[model samples]
Target: MTSTPPHQSVLDKPFVLDLFAGPGGLDVAGHRLGIPSLGIEWDKQACLTRYAAGLETLHADVSAVRRDSFESLPPEINVLAGGPPCQTYSVAGRGAGRQALEDVKGYIKRLMAGESDAEIDKKLMRLSDPRTALVLEPLRYAIQATRSPNRGHRPYDVIVLEQVPAVEALWERYAEVLQDTGLPDGTKYNVVVDVLKTETYGVPQTRSRAVLIARREGLGDAPSLPDPTHRAYEAKEWNRRNGGIAAAPVTQQTLYDVDAPEPRRRPTEDARLEHWTSMGDALAEPVGIKHRGRKAPFLVRSNYGSSGIPGRRGVRTDRQPATTVTGRISRFVVFEHLGHDVVCEGPRFSMNEAGMLQSFPPDYPWSGTAQAQQVGNAVPPLFGAHLLSAALGLPAPAAEAMREPWVPAAEEQRAKLRSHGCGAADGCTARCPRPV
Candidate 1:
């Protein structure tokens, strides 16, 4: 019989309003760190998943949520966080640049106008209007109304936003609009967390995302991106257990195959071998091309070319960690490859496994179809917890003791550096250091 895993939250004990809160990736992350977070998502299925995981969630359009709606609940909201949809500005879709920002601003402007403002309310009610514009409306409303010196209330202490790298530049506008709302002119609001990832934090899959952390000036410093607890890049003195400045690199092997459940043995070795071989060939050769030598594995499976190879030739793979997981895609069929070659393909990752790769707790219950699982699309819970913790000026949870592969190489290098007496206490040089 299999043993159940222990239960513990990932982030601080409580935060406010998981905006754009699809399937509560942010909420799960906050929970993992012991942080309490409420979620607001339009999708009912997504909200159900959050509710199942013990989160306070609202199934409603975020834009339509009014500051007045929660006025009776509490006077303080610790954090405001979410990743608004990015397809409007994603590379794959139409690059809806500044216009998208304008639409978002318009939404907030509409929300800020009271119901008494019949003209503005009518325009906001237009069904043809883009709802994405309303995504940030509540934030803008809270920002404007909450800033009066004696208003007897405070908005969220910190505003945390996440999106694709392409949206990095838009933060400037986000900051500007936020400031226009109630924040003081000099309010040091807006911190761009450039490097956030599940893989870097030991989630196995390397999912990169940018998180924007902003807070009122007097409320302490803006959230700092958590130091990588686990290294995805190899460094000479980085140790997994030792808490220090130097971090170690995470390996691909550690991310993919580690902690995975045993695969279902096919009826015959020939079948299994053939499956492995085919996947091996795909990994060896870039996707889209047939290899001559190795008999491609016997796995007869359908393949979909999602990420187009540049050359449309030889094997390829993406060196950087993969984009967010859509879930439901077969594992053996490589959606992303190195250049054109498939990497490792065997069985489709289980929902729980994908969630782990995305940094969700092993037992976090996620409701919905594989497409709606939100495993890959959501931010890793660990990374989210760290960011939320930093925003709230709370201490990070103690990291679990785990074996790290890079430790050996790092130790070997550290030993050589120690003899020279040139190594810092942690043996890390700000820039890449070469031993003399």
Candidate 2:
């Protein structure tokens, strides 16, 4: 659910191309930044959600769509953003999934060696999981876009990709390929890859994602990643690494034991870094029907009646950030208060609250029946906004800008702050914001 940013560098790119676009999170962020965008999503359910929310989307399996078809679009369309499905690459599913990585890499190598799609698919079909190969779609688009047969189209100006941390090595591989490959006009890209924690950027959940940003080569200097604004855990690492000196020390962050009688964290060292919002803040107003079965009183997944430790099954008290809002968000039970014994129904997060945590409109017009899956799969539009802001060549935004709900720009408000004027023969304009 990562991608978005702040800035000294504002986006000059007029539009973004979101591939494997899930529920329009990236597009939502792009719209807020005055960048018009569209998404290509394969899932009918997510596309239904996209249409209900009034976000633009094209329904098609990203893998089934040919990259050459993109040549039909106007050359002005440039920034590319997407998060390919990561279930196969996620650490949570790593037992059989991890063991398949080597085989997956082998398949990718064959495809790289110019094997026919039919040939590779035949072999991949034999793997325990073929989804692992889907990770290469983004790279396929990047490589193809950078070397389009059409003479007039320019390569993508910026590329933003996100996935679970275990797939970072794949992004790093793509970065290497982008570095080594260039356009017919000698245009190349400067790429940066890193694993980021969404909570560090004001997300209520502590989800971690591997993010990649690639800017067309010779855009003055290389692209920089966005800086963090909120303080949850160790603002010091950010401050020291980025040469930032804050007025006060960062507040400590800790989660309370679900079964503990008292809170588990230390007192704040002043409130400067407490901007990290909690499950309490986002879910303050609940709208979903609470489950009220006394027999299954606030039970969490798998360990409904265990006395071992609450950590086995997280407590849904608002004291801490909610556990990663996975499909599992619906399995946990809620308590009325931090130390109260009262039990509340169903899941810890409603689909609306989950959307809010991911920086979507709380009441976004949702179209699908798999509410938790749709909510769990989105990038926080606020976070995507930050990543897009950085990709557009702006400096990281102050944390305060991210603390509240994101407000998008009007269509008429679109304006370019290019350092270099438009229609230049060389196509150079942006000034890179140094990475923090």
Candidate 3:
């Protein structure tokens, strides 16, 4: 279990419960922003990861959770958050077919009704209660919930949803639900759907996530959306939407382009440049394998570019924001090392990097194999710190490096290396053999 810090007091102490909380990404963010959280996940490794992050977690299937049991806890649980498994709604998953939709619908019904049958109670936990406000994610579940017979009839005070562009239709449904369940006179609601990237908020990777926040009547003028504080762009079309005297558009350069006076175009041979351009590579330490076939299953293409795989040199750029980092790096972005123009034939984003880009603290522990650790995961606490800080009208606290054995030894080693005039290639340009 991760040890809690001494002499450090949590900020607001808003009690939160995370359902399907993978490695406590959301919980970490909440805590960094002053809210205390508990996580519920069935995967033992994921549960351990969350526990290591100093969160109290329940290692049980979400379907088996007893609402009556949670309701039994004090009413201090101000926020309830979770993303039901996305595979059901995933564009690639069972095609969101009738069976898939019905299965999820059944879950939503249990979520809102707080009712549990013998069969479902044996497998899942329900979240449909008034005391513990719900903040559902991925947009798909939220949209479906709004359309059910329980429309506008929910117990929570706020509903925040997020997803990819392909799921925007879900947001429209959320909007309609809000209209149908018109708020009481004094209650207010906000529906924000836009492209928000991790880099703009200080994460190193260039990941754009579409966020939708719906405020119930009581949560104080739905937390104001965090305004963009930084900027960069990919090409002319990248900023076609932002004209009139804007700063540089948020691009790969914003995070990686340090010390360079202007945006520099790197030729294909510069592996370092390619790594920086590839969000996945930037977060990953190369695995010493040449491009053979597809490396990971979750391969994503954002744009078009040239390739060098014999006759298969196809150019694809990842302009669109990535789907969730499912801990499967191969599922996020593509990579190419064929000495020709680099092609992202595999997923480029790693779950770890994506989590960091999502504001997870640098030290948050990830579970499962390396691939699972990289893609399918949580937005780091660091990312949540920015958003939560804004919501609570407080300054984000400085991150305290964890003093675990795994980390301190690395710090000591780096210090030793620094004394000998030897450091990683990225740092020691003059003294080291390779500069880059």
Candidate 4:
């Protein structure tokens, strides 16, 4: 008799269906928590990475599944999670989605009013970018699963959605509709919507995302956002107002040793939370140099503009959290911070170091082209765990678990790559396995 794997055997009810699931970031969190999940991604490269990571995935466009009203989905799925494409909505890209925000809201009203899909698609195609309409796909799935007779009429117990900060208004619209249109069983959804700082959740990168969570009212108390377990990054105060220059070498003092006077704490400041994690904390072993038996700090210089100022690159000491990891990661340069005003340029961050900063495992099997872009697009698994725990009404994982090293399922493959001294960075021409 053959035995089932641990992840498959533990798959009972409350499965998650993730849409636009690039590289399975949220799915990784679900797997670690013993929850079953399947992701649907249109990108072949992302699908390759997902398969390599042993994640369940449907290699197809989300619109294809929407045509069947999600009839192909597993009946046991009771949770809906998605992070839709944010290119048009992001500040780095053209402001197509941002400009069409009002039109998108109008489309939501149309969806709520029982408009036909053909009619909606026709109107959506006229927008600046048709992909912007995908932001509404989650609502379409939710409506089908809950109200459509063709589907099994199984209502999702919890719904979670996240996107760029520009999508906050859209999520607010989601909250209003989800609450107004209660479940078929007469129980409304209790919803919460807000922008969350990833650094506060122990991600060693400073990034923010808009999040919306809704739970069926009859299940229990209303869902709430997870309390931050780490302090928020205060760059100005921490930098001692040095005009964005490093105050001192990282090896000499702790991250909190600032020369400036202490500023008043914000309302969200909690005495119990720990200090925000820094790049030194996340990439100490891989990126730090050995100096007199102790780890020495480094500097990362951004070629892009700092805070919307063109041509002014940003520099951060390893003692501070890394700036938002973006698709343009090649533009970042690393330098060894030699004491007494000496500096030496070094190799850029390896794939492992970049992923580690984003709270992914150091050994995560990144496959396909543009791996850095995949890492940048993913939700930090550590942050997702806290969000999932809150939405499911489960006890949060221990804070220490965030720092625990993770070994990917495909250890043999990783071992082979390490043997070849291939660090999986750009310009590497290793004969490693690519997705077939």
lDDT tens digits, residues 125-157, model 1? 553435434545545545543543433545556
Q: How do these models rank on TM-score, best leading?
A: 4, 2, 1, 3
The 10-residue segment with the lowest total lDDT in model 2: 414-423
Local error of candidate 1 at 62, Å? 1.1
What TM-score would you give candidate 3 relative to the actual structure? 0.53
What lDDT score goes with residue 284 in model 1? Answer: 31
Query: Candidate 4 lDDT, tens digit per residue, 1-436?
Result: 0111233211135588989889877887776667778888777677667766767766666887778536757777888999999999998889899999999999998888778889998899899898899999988888778764554576778888899999999999989888996533344688999999999989999999999989876777889998898888887776655434553343323223323343456776797887888887877654222111114466777755566552366677777788998776766877774566656776788766777778876666678899889988888888887787788876665544544444444656534423322233222233332333
Please give the CA lDDT of all the candidate structures: 0.47, 0.60, 0.41, 0.73
> Where does model 2 exceed 4 Å of error?
1-11, 72-74, 94-97, 103-126, 147-153, 181-187, 234-274, 285-311, 337-348, 395-436
**What are the per-residue Cα lDDT tens digits for candidate 2 across 91-167?**
66654556776676665566555566668767867877667767777756655565565625456778899988887
In candidate 1, how many Å is residue 158 off? 1.5
- Arrange candidates, best lDDT first: 4, 2, 1, 3
Per-candidate RMSD, Å = 18.9, 11.7, 14.7, 7.1
Judging by lDDT, tell me the better candidate of 2 and 4. Answer: 4
- Indicate the TM-score of model 1: 0.59
- TM-scores for all candidates? 0.59, 0.72, 0.53, 0.83
* Per-model tally of clashing residue pairs: 51, 21, 49, 0
Better of 1 and 3 by TM-score: 1
Better of 2 and 4 by TM-score: 4
